[model samples]
Target chain A: MITKLAYKNILGNGWRSLINIFILSLVLTGMIWMQGLYDGWSRIARRQMQEWEFAGGHYAHQDYDKYDSFSLDKSFAAVPPKLQDLIDTGDAVPILYSAGIIYPHGRLTPVVIKGIPAEQNILRIPTTHLRIQDPDTQILPVLIGRQMAKSINVVKGDILTMRWKEVNGAYNAYDIQIVQIMDTPVPSTDMGQIWIDYDKLNEVKALKNSCSVIVLKNQAASTYVGSPWNFVSIDQSMKGVDAMIQTKRVGGYVFFVLLLFLAMIAVFDAQMLAVFKRRKEIGTLIALGMTKRQIIGLFTMEGTMYMLLGSVLTATLGLPLFFYFGFQGFPIPQQMSDFNIAGASEPIRCYYSPIMILSTFMIVMAVTVFASWLPSSKIARMKATYALLGKV
Target chain B: MRKLLILTLLISVSVGMVFAITAEDILMNIDKNMTAKTTWSSSRMIISTRRATRTLSSVNYSKGNDISYSEYTAPAKEKGTKMLKMKDNLWLYDPSTDRVIQISGNMLKQSVMGSDLSYEDFMDDLELLESYTAILDNDITYDNRKCYKLILTAKTSGLSYFKRILYVDKERMIPLYQELYAKSGIKLKTMKLSDVRKVGNRWYPMHIVFKDELKAGSGTTIINDDIEFNISIPDYYFSKAILKK
Candidate 1:
């Protein structure tokens, strides 16, 4: 009975009720869109990281620390015989790392030298470009990421002087031609890094059959690796990307609260004014044997009904916007690449999951009902005579 | 008979002079003037960057090339910072933190106090003749003095510089100018030695400048304000414990 009464009241309120419904729907739409953006960014970042750098897992030398550049020289270990079989069978690839400096445009810049096999398909890096033959071995073919190439101001065919210390501490330097500039979304595989043929680098460093990391084709390939090599799982590798998305999500909370606040204030103001102007109606309901609790419930139900109608309107109004963004994707700016974020260079397609929609709806409805009930509770304190005369 | 004797004497003297100086002999003489058995010195290092220049003063004590200690004495920001080199191990004590850190492996190759010189350069204690094979290229006039141009190739793989082109002052047996090259034949650094001074029958350059070819800067100059050769240095000066003291 109260539900029917509340529905009639919402309709009787006319344009005022329509305005409240419109505001609620807009807030819901904004919340859903923001959620979709975060979800889309997180999804793309993880996928791109897996594609460009971490394939399935990494078997890194125990001494190798991603944070410590100084560990590059001492972190290499002899490839375990079992893991070597995987490499030979194309299920894995060995990578050697060295700390080096490159003179690009005659300016010295520090770089991390990564040596990957030319024939390996474990990662998306264009290592095949590193296979060119150099007559007399004067200038070796090397690969640089686009960001690295840009920062150093070089392009394909530009020769840079690369210098590094050998395993025995002898410094070796040579001219390196940039055969390819890889456009990788993952910063770890790119910025301040150089890629060369694995055999050539190993030979130059005089570290035979040794590597700093063995990238596996899948998690199953890790079974072949053993001591002095620690397996870094895919989840473990995505920690950086996850942390970045989480931080962004936390930062979005303030915006979300403001949107919710706008809708709540509108509903709260309407409910307070309705209580003030309809005191005679409230007194008649009390005189007719309707309880104060019942009257408050009716008003609260009306505010919740606005949310329910707003949800239906949101579905109607938000469907086209969601579909457009879902298919077309939101274009990311080019300058975002400087932040070293994975997938920041690519468009993020919004993902509107059912759970995300339902939760947002429930949260907005609860706040709306609370705002309605707070003002409606004043009916319990009103005297039937005073309300009957339309006095406060 | 007198004419024949005079001609024989002239030819014999010329032959003796030609045989007197070989590449190895010149290297030995240069090494004797460059290195010392024990030495103590007060020096100032001036490092120049594109933006500005900084000068630091220090007192140095050394026994051979393998063991040495330095403590910065001037520039309040750098004062009390000490470095001790024992063989391949290099430790730095920063008074700010009162901590000593051992720099090893590739860390030794990094510049010292942002200077053009690296710890590896200071840790190199081997005599030139022990680590390199010298071939005399030719004679050249350098710094208005007759100098022997010699090319030295590393006899082993682990030496800092693979090849060094040195211009040795013929009279003083000190290298006036040097070009340090990597194995790839690219010149990595150049050094100039000037202000030659004699102490106890040995010639030593008091002013040395080192320039890293790959870096953009005016380079670093080291001036030895006071020096002593073959003098007894306190044994405690080279100890690790002395870094904190």
Candidate 2:
């Protein structure tokens, strides 16, 4: 009998129920979208971070960088010679680099050029980043990011100039072939980066002996260490990249909350008015043999039925948006992508996170229950005569 | 017969004193020689798995300050370059643009060519005797050199390498082998010194071999190809204006 009454009240207002359901679904759609974005961004950031950390991210020490003390000393070549024998004898990633300065064609600015050999567009740098590819070299030389390449006005086939400077304030530039350009991965990297091939750079710098950094990876079972004037990290040095990746992720989380919060305010207002309009009816029920629990249950069930209808409509509207973006993300403005935002190196790709979507629906149910709480509890507390008679 | 016996005993005593030199005394002599500020020229080669790369440079090194000037050459490229360091300031000049720019401290973290050397490793001039006290650890043969195994403990913190055990040569007063230890008491690296040569009345290390503790199979070897010592170099070459490249 109670369930029958609950069903009647749900459709009691005819088209009014449709209006309420539409408003609630719209609010829910916003909440789901925002929540999905945040969760998606977080997963992408973590995956990318893991890749970089495994690639010697921990070796890029920021604390030690403050000393203003790094240079190539032609006098201290104590460690370079036997490096080849060890690489051949042991299993080690051929982590190598060569540094030089280059002035891109048309752009006269001489920039610090670097050539990194190996995979280019993966964890650390995303693919949408434009780089000039080398046509001839089997080893693809990369062009640095859009902003840097534009500033230097370098396409492909431009000659890069390298100058070896000594402590005596004298230096001479060596000409290097420009095979590729690399994008400045982050704002920090963008501020100081140029491009060339690793082999060509080694030749020009005459640094078959000098490499600025080494990135190495080998099978896990094959390693060991000694007196380290070096360092180790918590995420194994994942934090350096994490700090940058975090900037792009925070947006999605906040947007989720914004969507749900706005919907909640509207829900609260709608319920308040609905409950007030039904006061006379509630008063009569309380005056009769209906106990306070029965009155509260009646109003709560009616509100829940409306919410159930709202959720169905909301999910129908929301899933398609997710799939649309999952296939083809909304394009970010080129100008905005180029700007120096803290975490996002490139424009983001929007996608879905299953956990986020499920969690969001649960959250909406919780909010709907709370929104009904005030109205139902009031129904329980209504006075018999004043509530029913429409008293002044 | 009594006078002859006394003269013979005195001569024998003098010869014994001449042959016996304590490890501490030898270290003290090397420490003193290290104190003199001087200029020198050397060609160093970094030997790696990929290829051999070499740099020929003239250097002016000073004690207690990071002020030095190096005029380096790319023998392979027919190129010459100069760098100057005054205190903490560094600069390098681009002969192409004729422009000078300051180098950041981070560049030093890079490996010196294809070798096991860092930029800080190249500046390994401060002998432990000046900053730390040495104790004879034990006798050890390092790379076939008979050595007085000695342990050195730093009196101060923040040194480049804190705890080191050196296997010093018994005859030449040079460190034939060295073991570097971490703060946690783990051995970090092992280094061997070989090919000792005399330049201008003084003996200097001509070659060094280093092995990483973690990369057990891989190591670095550095050879100083050309060596000159006690040459004159200007002090002003070590300044901010000079480090710009």
Candidate 3:
């Protein structure tokens, strides 16, 4: 019965209820949009990293430290015999890293030369371009990314000289012909890096069947772990990316809290004013044998009804806008893409998952009900005679 | 007439033979002129880059060619920084950290105090003839003085530079110009020596400039304000314990 009364009261209130519903719906829509951006970005970052660099995970030589560039030369170890089977079967790819200097147009710049198999399909890296008719050609065929090409100012088919130290400390130099310029979003794979065939690099480096890292085709391939080869899981590799997103989400939370607070405040104020002006109605309800608790419930239900209606309005009006972002994606500005963070180069497609939407709705609805009940709870202390006279 | 021509030709040939020196002899003299048993010096380094220029003053002490110690005394930010070198090992003491850290392996290649000079450059104390085999090229005139161009190739694998082209003053036996090269035949650095002065019985360069080709800058210039060759330095100065003290 109290619910029926609350519904009728909400309708009769007209414009006041409409204002409250509009504010609630607006806040909900904004909250969901902000959440969709973060979710979409995180998802895209991990997916791209997995596709381009870490297919399943990495099995790196024990001495390899990404932060320590000096460790590159000594980081390689002989591939364990068991893992070699995976390599032969095309379920894994071995990579070698060498610290080298490139002379582009006779200007020197330090670069890390990574050697992968030309026929490897384990990762999205364009190693097929590294395939050459004769590996023993005096000029080595190399691949570089767009960012590196821009920084070094080189184009496809440009021949540059590269120098590196052998395992025994002898230095060698060769002419490298740029075969392909890749457009990769991952900065670690693109910037200050070059790609060449694995066999060619090993032959020049004079190391047989050795690699700095082995990229597995799937998580199940991690069983081939051996001494001097440590398996790095996908979660471990993505820790840095997760921390970055968490930091950004913390800043976004403050704005969301404020928006929700304003919506709740509007409902709270309206509830307080309604209780003040409707003293005669409260008295009439008491005289008509409706308990004071029932009267409070009626007011509380009215506030909740506003939220319920807002949710309905959000579903009807916000669907098209969500769909637009879902389809077209939000383009990242050019300035932001240069931040060196992975996945910033690509557009972020907003993903509104059911769980994310439902949780947001529940949290907002709870806050609204609490705001409505706080002001209405005062009726429990009022005397029937005093309320009839409209005395506070 | 034939007898007179033969006599004149013999005299000319004899003069050329008497004046010419072997590459080994030239290298030995250069070593003798540059290396001292012990030396103490106060010098200033002016490091210049495209963005800015920084000047640092330091006191240096060396024993033989293997042991050396230096402490920066000027430039408030760099003051109290000390470095000690013992053969292939190098240790740096920073006043801010109050700790001593050993720079080893590939870390030695890092620039010192943001200058074009690397820590490996400091630890490279082997005599030129000891590390490189000298080959004499044709004579050339530099700075209005006769100079012998000697191309030095490294005899070992682990040296910082694989080859060097040195221009040695014929009379003073001091290197006036040098070009350091990598094994790939690319010029990596150039050093110019000037302000030649006789200190005691040996000739020395009071001013030197070193340019790192891989870096973008005008390079570093070192000026010796005061120098004492063959002076006895305290034993404690070269000790690792002095790094913290």
Candidate 4:
């Protein structure tokens, strides 16, 4: 009986009830869309980082600190025998890095020279471009990222002079040719970086079989340890991005809560108005032998029914919008390509997991019901005689 | 017999005059007039930027071309700063942090104390005669003094400047002007020395100006206020421990 009356009353009010339901539906859709986009962005970013830069993780010399360019001189050692076996089996790729200065068009800019195997398939870097076996040309072949090339003002087939300190503390300089300009998402591996063949760099430095860090294919397959070399796990390597996502997630929650609060206010206001304006109807129902507690229960059910209808409205309207967006991913801005933010340069495809959708639905519904009940509970405090006379 | 002997003597004298001044002879004379076995000097470096000018005073000690140390004595903020250069290594001591950091790699290319000179320039200990092959180009008048224009080319691949043009005073064997060039023949920097004085048997320039062509504004001027050559500077002065004092 209460359900029939609540349904009739909601339909009877028409536009007022529609407004409440519409606001609630809009809030639900916005929350779902925001969460899906955030998830998509973070997923792409983590994948790019793993594929292009970290590569499961790394085993680095103890003094090999990426932040300290000064440490690059002392951060190299001969590849350990255990790690060497992994390299031979194609499970690892050794990388040697040193600080260098390059003069492109006679302008001096600092660079980090990274040497990796030209034939290795360990990392996603396009190292095959460095495999030009030219015996007659003294120009060393090098690969640079697009951003680095733009900043240094050099393109493929351009020859520039590069200067660096050898392992013996002697300086060496020579001309290098830009063979490729890579397009990669990770800026740490791209900006201010130069890629060369590992063997050639070793020959130039006169330090055979030495590397700054060794990248592994599988993080969990080895437990290698030594005095000067230590392993960094994948989670440890990506901790910064994880923390950044966590902070953004907290901000998303605050925004969702604010949206929920606005929708709840509309429901609460409608319930308060119903109790005030429908006193004569309440008196008539009581006069017709309905108990006062039953009258309160009816009013409460009326208020809760708005949320039930709002949820149905949200599903009918939001699912189609979500599907449309899911098919056509959001376009990333062109300027975002210059940012150091990983994966932001790529289009974000919305990811709507069942768990994320279900939880969001439950949380919004609970808030809506609670918002209805708070105002309807006032019926219990009012005197029945005063309520019947519509005197509050 | 007297006529034949005189004719042979004249021929020998003419030949000796023709082969007298080689590139090595001029370079050795310039090196002798430029450096001492050990020296102590009080100097001031004045750097001028577009915004303002800063003057720094220091007491410098050096042995040959390799080991040198300098402690900033003025401009209160830089008073306790010290630098020690031994061979290819350079260490800077900052009193505020009480930390000694070795300047290496790319850091060597940065300017020293916002001056036109880089730490690499400060740590460069290569003697011109040992690192380059000099050729006598011509004689030119520079700064109202007759100068021998000599061109020096790097003997190896990795020297900072691949070629340099130097003008040495004909009488004093002191360099009056120099132009440094990169491997691509780009003019990188230029130095002009003046205020020549006779100290002992050698003539030295008391004032020098170094200009970095890559930058704007006026160049850096280094004035040797008081200098004592071939003095007894103890070996401990060049040690890293002296930086703390």
| Best model number under TM-score | 1
lDDT of 4 at B118: 85
True contacts kept of each: 0.66, 0.12, 0.20, 0.12
Write the residue-wise lDDT of candidate 2 on A279-323 in tens digits. Answer: 787777777778888877766666676678888897788678767
- Highest lDDT scorer: 1
Tell me the TM-score of model 2: 0.50
Which digits, one per residue and each the tens of the lDDT, describe model 3 over residues A286-321? Answer: 878888789888988998999999998888888887
lDDT of 1: 0.89
**Model 2 off-target regions past 4 Å?**
A1-4, A14-16, A42-100, A104-146, A164-172, A181-191, A195-259, A339-349, B1-245
lDDT of 3: 0.87
Regarding lDDT, does 2 or 4 come out ahead?
4
- The true-versus-predicted C-alpha distance at residue A129 of model 1, in Å, is 1.5
State which candidate, 2 or 3, has the greater DockQ: 3
lDDT over C-alpha atoms for residue A335 of model 4: 89
**Tens-digit per-residue lDDT, A12-48, candidate 4:** 8788889988988888888889888878777878889
TM-scores for all predictions: 0.90, 0.50, 0.86, 0.77
Docking class of 3: acceptable
User: Candidate 1: deviation at residue B42, Å?
Assistant: 3.1
Lowest-sum lDDT 10-residue window in model 2 chain B: B50-59
Interface RMSD of each: 1.9, 16.9, 3.9, 5.4
Tell me each candidate's RMSD, in Å, in order: 3.4, 19.0, 4.2, 5.8
Candidate number that wins on TM-score, 1 or 2: 1
Q: Give the winner by lDDT: 1 or 4.
A: 1
